[model samples]
Target: MISCSPAEPVVPKEGGGNRERGAAPRWILADFDDTLAPGDSHAGLLRYILRRRIWPLLLLPVIALGGVVYLVPSQRRRGISLIWWAITLGLSPLGWRKLVRAYCHTRPGLFREAHRLLEEEGHRCWVLSASPRALVRAQLALQRPANLPYRTIGSRMHYRLGGLMPRFYCHGQHKLLPEICALDTELALSDSLHDLPLLGLGEQGWLINPTPARLEKARARLPHLMVKNWQL
Candidate 1:
């Protein structure tokens, strides 16, 4: 017969909580347009089309109508923008790619020191934008380091039945829903007050080169956000 002895108490493993926290990947959500580049990519694409193709000139009335539609309400703006895209620049994906490449070439300094710092910190970075996905992807591919792994979520366009269709419009206050549904955001970087919703989701928020009024508004909403100025 074996003699019974006092039971030893169980001890929690050292840094057990740290191990659990480390398992969850860190993600940095960055806005594409002004945050990455000096100007808005959507407006740049529109300008590119207007300068390169004469056909879009004939649709001046349609473009004007779209501009008016954009002012109506935030909910309806995406639809109007999509319609404008289809009418003006959605004729050929190949053509769009070429245009995007040409546009990116002029903006060599698109990827700034902030992006480098984020990457250096071992955080997975992604671009979230109201600009079309194709355009944003093309811009990143052109500007970012080849070895750095990054992804983009933005408005999507699909080619169906010999026409381009707007598949998704990731924008405005609702921009974070589509992105955060799949991944957790550790940090967020943006230049506009429009990204307030997205900035609110991040564990850390960075406002880059925001105007004084916009900065004040952001501070009121997210007082903890880190402010930094970046120039093109």
Candidate 2:
């Protein structure tokens, strides 16, 4: 099972603690998939659908088409996510939760050292992901240790006419929307170069488990980012 080391206490500085009262909170913007979990929630969900035979093999073509759509530029990824949501619209909320919880239970080794280091430093952490908000929230709720506190921001889903629908796709550059951009982000962590825009929002960044080519590209684009190897 996934577990966390004991958190070190945050010592207040002299003179009744450091910094002026009402200072802007420092936050660590972290990616959910790969950064926290061993696998992607979206991919896990797809695997569940396949294993359960919830849909016929005929639907695979449509799913493949959605994947193609995701590769297109100019906000098309949002459309692709929406398509996937529509395809899975028949699943009840309780059923969805069960699937997510089962997936979370099987994935161990979450809360990596990098995560511990950030939290130990007393930074408020927020998970930022392109994955559907409900799935991300469910996984975090199951996997996160009680001692660690965190908030999550991800693509939202809306229930309309008794079906779940995509309300937002928080991926790529969209991860740095104005609401998120306004935060006093001290650091950001991510595995994919797609998160470069989000990484740029933070004063410092860490690229986790990136390919050598991707690392070189990120270094060229973000010279100040620290690269770290993380086994997932």
TM-scores of the candidates in the order shown: 0.80, 0.80
Best candidate (score: lDDT): 2
Off by over 4 Å in 1: 1-22, 76-83, 86-90, 121-123, 159-165, 178-182
**Candidate 1 C-alpha error for residue 36, in Å:** 2.0
Worst 10 residues of 2 by lDDT: 1-10
Off by over 4 Å in 2: 1-22, 118-123, 159-163
What are the per-residue Cα lDDT tens digits for candidate 1 across 1-232? Answer: 1111113211111121223654877677788788867788777777776778777677677677767677665545544564456455546877767777787776645646655654574247777888888777777666655633366788886665554545776775647564463555677788987777667666678898888888898888678778877764
What TM-score does candidate 1 get on C-alpha atoms?
Answer: 0.80
- Residue 104's lDDT within candidate 2 is 64
Question: Candidate 2: lDDT of 79?
Answer: 52
Per-candidate total of colliding backbone pairs: 0, 0
Report the Cα lDDT for residue 54, model 2.
59
Cα displacement (angstroms), candidate 1, residue 178, comes to 5.2
